[model samples]
Target chain A: MTNRHDHRLIDGRAVQARILTELRAELERERAIRPVGRLLSVSIGPSPEIEVYVRNQARGAERVGLPFERQLWPADITQEECKRRIAALNDDAEVLGIILQRPVPAHIHVRSLQSAIHPLKDVEGMNPASIGNIVYNDVALAPCTAAAAVELVRETGLNLRGLEVVMIGHSEIVGKPAAFLLMAEGATFTVCHHMTRSVAMHSRRADVVVVAVGKPHLIGPDMIKPGAAVIDIGINQVSAPDGTLRILGDVDTDRVREVAGWITPVPGGVGPVTVAMLMRNALTAHKRQVASGWLPPATLRGP
Target chain B: MTNRHDHRLIDGRAVQARILTELRAELERERAIRPVGRLLSVSIGPSPEIEVYVRNQARGAERVGLPFERQLWPADITQEECKRRIAALNDDAEVLGIILQRPVPAHIHVRSLQSAIHPLKDVEGMNPASIGNIVYNDVALAPCTAAAAVELVRETGLNLRGLEVVMIGHSEIVGKPAAFLLMAEGATFTVCHHMTRSVAMHSRRADVVVVAVGKPHLIGPDMIKPGAAVIDIGINQVSAPDGTLRILGDVDTDRVREVAGWITPVPGGVGPVTVAMLMRNALTAHKRQVASGWLPPATLRGP
Candidate 1:
């Protein structure tokens, strides 16, 4: 493939690969001593929307040499039953972490199920406890997509301490968590949402701008500073003029890259790194479990 | 006492009084049907600093007709024992909520004890679960001081929707939680901590500025925009020229008040409202418990 994009384009796949390589080596050292656990993906119904995520996560896990399993419950499963199954996974010694697929049955209370996953094994970081820990600057285990956004921002080599960051969303999953993560990095951040009167005003003054508002091309070149880094976490699909489907990010990447010091492109930006973050979180969960004595110490096997 | 301050001074006592009065009436109605539970304050060691807080909380509980209990555990109590006692309180029907006092013994893990308190009985909202819930826009149960700061901002009659809010400080207890509360109220907030390069730059542009950093007189008149609302959550004790003790807030209130449309005074500002917020949270906890079937419905009593 011919390389046409400029150097300002943040290659998320390259970042994701670097993380997986490090994680793979770490897991190899861990596996030499004891057995590693599998990452269990629980889908409490038919969730076609999350199938892509499942495949990406499985691929990432495989690259890190971690076992991956997928479970599909009946679409009509009761919320109580769903929680009961999650509790079982939480207690399972063979399970390293749990990933609860979204778009669960309408009857199932997703938050309740998320809460059921033990924090030590909450690789997806969807649990309220995991989210809450971020407030205390405990960002080791955080939501994957949010962590991924922060990771990409770090990749830009911007000095996080005292950096001006503007997060263009306040969602529970991405924007809010990302704000706390930035805070943990000692960056001063402003959160803007639909309620914000002027997003550009904040973005233009920021050293870095992260958008997760699920709006395509919402940020233009004029909205960014000349040397500011822009992280686009939005994944929106729209039909092009040729009657073909296309994925677009919140930032107008074509024009933004011309002005932005660095920018993350759609499809190849936050998405791949998000899967990589899941892998990193799984390793962190495993290491924490061992440190906390929640899991048995590794028994030396045959050399 | 003669009132010397101008109308710009926000009387937290007044706001607190109004809240307590309404709670008193509501508790009276509940009392006619059934008994309200007591708020148990657990102190691990002898720390005289929180004594005033204990008294204020007791008084607030009394005003609302809720029973209050102050339990002083041994200074050498183990962390496990503290959690055990908290678990018992969580199970007790008479205990409407638990308040784990701060400055716990060095041997004790305070965060662990806070987590031990059941969410339904965490009237102080110090539990991770309660704090995490605020991220999801669930603000009914939040940290008292943070909620008090937000409450006073609301008292200013500023439209929170699209309000330009700048929160100085990022402590987990106050600044961080206050940021989440402001978000829940539809306000655009920026959080500045010790790492922020220019606190005045953000504050000068804010419609409302809330300061929780402990430094006395950290915010000056020049940092604030004219006619803006300033909420001072800092409580610092400093010596006056005569060597007498005087309480000071983060903002230089004397001069800031001239520019600030509304400003809260230290010693009488967030302090009283925090106690009032605790009482309100107690009632909220009780109602949620009842709705969750954790407590029995009140039976009507004969006149």
Candidate 2:
């Protein structure tokens, strides 16, 4: 049971489930018109962390009625091989939505595969065309995690317009795109990272906080706004003194809940929401392809 | 005489002259390979202010031995008409580079024209494709003002790695892109606008300060690093008590020069550097078009 000290925990499991349910209906609507919705993920290694992340994302896709393929290559795969796979996905008509999961083998720089992905099927928004579309207000997709964070905050019925929101971290996947996302929603924001003078100083004055630095409990109650909303985006499992593994948020969830009016827990918060968003993007991507008369000949259902 | 305080001003005037000289040599080089580069500017309205900026930029173009044409439309011109003229220039074989002067009638939106311009001729980096190219780190041009300000700072011989930078604006045209530009160079930065907190605190700690908020004298001597370099990117002219117009920067120049080791005066600092950068972009645009082998017969050039 959740207590007052924990405030109201954001049920990411339920949120993601409900969002995927909505997506399933959209997928049916899309399929009725054209049955060519397929999703692809480009993976480089077999690390436990990367595997679990992609595994759950696949589950979410299945629930939302999209076929997912995990193209696993060796850890030491050459950059050329990775690019070849991406180009193949671009050429493959069956694959509508593509996500090249991050922490991509350090050798495989993200920028190399951007041009390889078809801009319409770029669900992960790692490509510049997708990001530019978001920034320029064109009809285009956004990076899943950043877009999910923004939509989740909005789902909480939080009014972002003209709100003093402070975002900590600036990875292309989260921070930079999220700033532009909220800016589009009329919430002026400040982005602080390792290079910033004081992260807490900016966080304390904000009405809403989105912390995605991925460090365990990096943000504590002392750094939060009184009665503010906290969304913890870190999925870190740190070993305790007793040799036990404990999942933690970028925020000290225990202390922050007492001060925050609304809070999203670590494991159940942004993590699940990201998968749901990806599934939604897949449906949208397939719909565009079908409408443009470019889908593969996989008509599973009738209109 | 320019004193030691102004010793290494990077003298925008001198830099502009040198760039034009190089542009002329490049013209000869280009003519030897292909055809001469030509420039065209589409300025809306006869606002003397817009006219002055356009004229100065053109003068910089001429100083480099490149010829140019100017098309001035009425201030009441519709967005459709402006775009039509811009499209004509874009399709014109003689026009290798197109400069669309800003402050477009206060009611017309320029975004409509952003996607239509050839990425090669987008000297301002205002086009969506150019912005996308920057985000992806592809081979593309940057906004002239941001590129110039960065060059002027590096021209002073400072290594930007891990350096503290305070940018006092958030416009895509100047401050925001400048932050990304500096960050790409490994400099840590903080972007501030009307909404930032304790801006003075951030500014004083910067090893380098770039103020582009367009407010006259927003920064004072106290808001500067001792012996720090200042590049004023503002172009504001305010009337004094005696009814005379005076140009000032976001920084208080008179007192800041005492504490600041180097400074670029408001009028001559970033302004001339921007024009020089534009010429450089124009030449580069011409080269790309020539190399692409798609130049129309009338405007065709070869590499």
Candidate 3:
């Protein structure tokens, strides 16, 4: 019998490291000329989960020599106020990118606020316009999680063109955008979601399978095609027997790795890469702003 | 052998008539109070094909009691001139909706001109912003062809939620938007395009299949599941043995109808419904503009 651990485990940390290294060098080059812009993160109220993620992002930005700022608004802030604040940020020249943290106040219309972010500074790529542009194959700025999944597949040295990818999840932020990005790359793909009758039927036939349904271990070994690359985008919290919370992904990593030629692990897989992609997007947003004459090109002049 | 002609063919003309009847009644009600708005269509240069379609649209508009106007532009017009004209239409209070005919002069960036049309007046729903709004399930003014396909599926009276649907082709105007609309309806769907390997594999498993690849007879009887609902969105021109031209759809309708319980015919299937959908969208666009306070509420007053 073959051991599941013997299969290749996609190294998300390595990919993240490579991205940060490149970003660090780029930051150094830009800093030598003019002041680099800061990433603005807006959070309504506080949640321990969001704090941990925000801290991780701050660390990642620091390592890459990128400036980061966190803005905490009162929990009672009205939706209008949020949109107004986001619009102000859109106009701020110093704010290169804006990220409205998830799990915002229940009263907040998250999609409305997301749309208020200027597409140029929408570093998180949560804006509908950015996702829509994917239809036209204009992917300068795409959703981070979706882009990360595509990157992991590309890391396997696979040619995206004509590749068969089955994506299980159709959320606007993840599944749909990822499918669109893959389509743009010339890969024929399928999108499945909660309404899907048989997820395995599609997964078993794909060269690449991306599961982002937020259901722990929803995809098993039987669902994966042998030699296929599996990207697990789900990050679910499960209570262990010891009453400790554990992070889990959509795929049964251990069992799937036995069948899949390559697979991404739960904690170390798409999560780290998503953060790295966020930083990359910020840099991209800045460059685009410069190219579009939104910012002064002279700002890059060396002292 | 079972007769394929026995299966219930989704009648596009019937559905179109149903929609027009409803629109006519509503238009009469609105007209009793104030002058309703007109749908403006801008066509660059002359094409007999486009004229035929535009004439069909005029008839549909007349049937619905809505005002219609067509603006013809010189073929040698610059892109700037095109955008300038579209912007003027955007500012026109009397124009409820705008349609930019296809096959514009070769030099014009068609997409650029589409983007200039105000989203409210974008009756065709070809603008990126309108397409992007589908991400949030805002179908107020979705693309007519895509929406028409969805309407055909709804006409089958099959609950879309949890239905297995296979969509062939991924063109921005048809496949992608249709997929998005189905996703919004809670349907499990797969999108297959030219890069897809073995399109039959996905088609055979679908409870509902929609083909919009513009290839005649791309899907045959062998590809369909028994008792499934088939919606054909393709409009292809083929040459007959006698060198006569004929219209065709993506599916081999006759053979597939033997296996499929519900199917739409080629010329009479999605085509007429699409024209009706255009008129429906025009009315929807007008309503949305009024609701958003962009237009006078008095226009919707009753007798």
Query: Which candidate should be chosen as best, given lDDT against the real structure?
Result: 1
List the candidates ranked by DockQ, beginning with the highest: 1, 3, 2
DockQ values of all predictions? 0.81, 0.24, 0.63
Fnat of each candidate? 0.65, 0.20, 0.65
lDDT of 1 by residue, B180-268 (tens): 99988899999998999999899999999999989998999999999999999999999988999988899898888878899998878
Q: B222-259 in candidate 3: lDDT tens per residue?
A: 99999999999988889999999988888888888878
Q: What are the per-residue Cα lDDT tens digits for candidate 1 across A106-205?
A: 7888898888999999999988888888887778789999999999999998889999999998999999999999899999999998999998889999
Docking class of 2: acceptable
What is the RMSD, in Å, between candidate 2 and the native fold over all Cα?
Answer: 6.0
- Tell me each candidate's RMSD, in Å, in order: 1.7, 6.0, 2.8
Tens-place lDDT digits, model 2, residues B1-303: 335346745578777777778887887776665565578787777767787788888798778767888887788988787778777777777788878777767877877666667787887777765766665445357788988889888877888776667788767667766766776676666666675546776788778889998888888999988988888898888999999998777777777888887788777778888988888888888777877775633434565
Ranking by TM-score: 1, 3, 2
Per-residue lDDT value at A302 in model 2: 47
Q: What are the clashing pairs of model 2?
A: none
* Residue lDDT tens for model 3, A1-303: 223245479888889999999999997887765666899989998777898789978988988988899999999999998888888898888999998999987899899898899999999988877877877678889899999999999989999988999999888898888988988887888787777777777788899999989889888898888999999999999999999998899888888887888888888889889999999998899888888887776654445
Candidate 3 residue runs with Cα over 4 Å from true position = A1-7, A30-35, A299-303, B1-7, B241-243, B299-303
Per-residue CA lDDT of candidate 2, range A241-295, in tens? 9999978778888778878878888778888998887877777777677667787
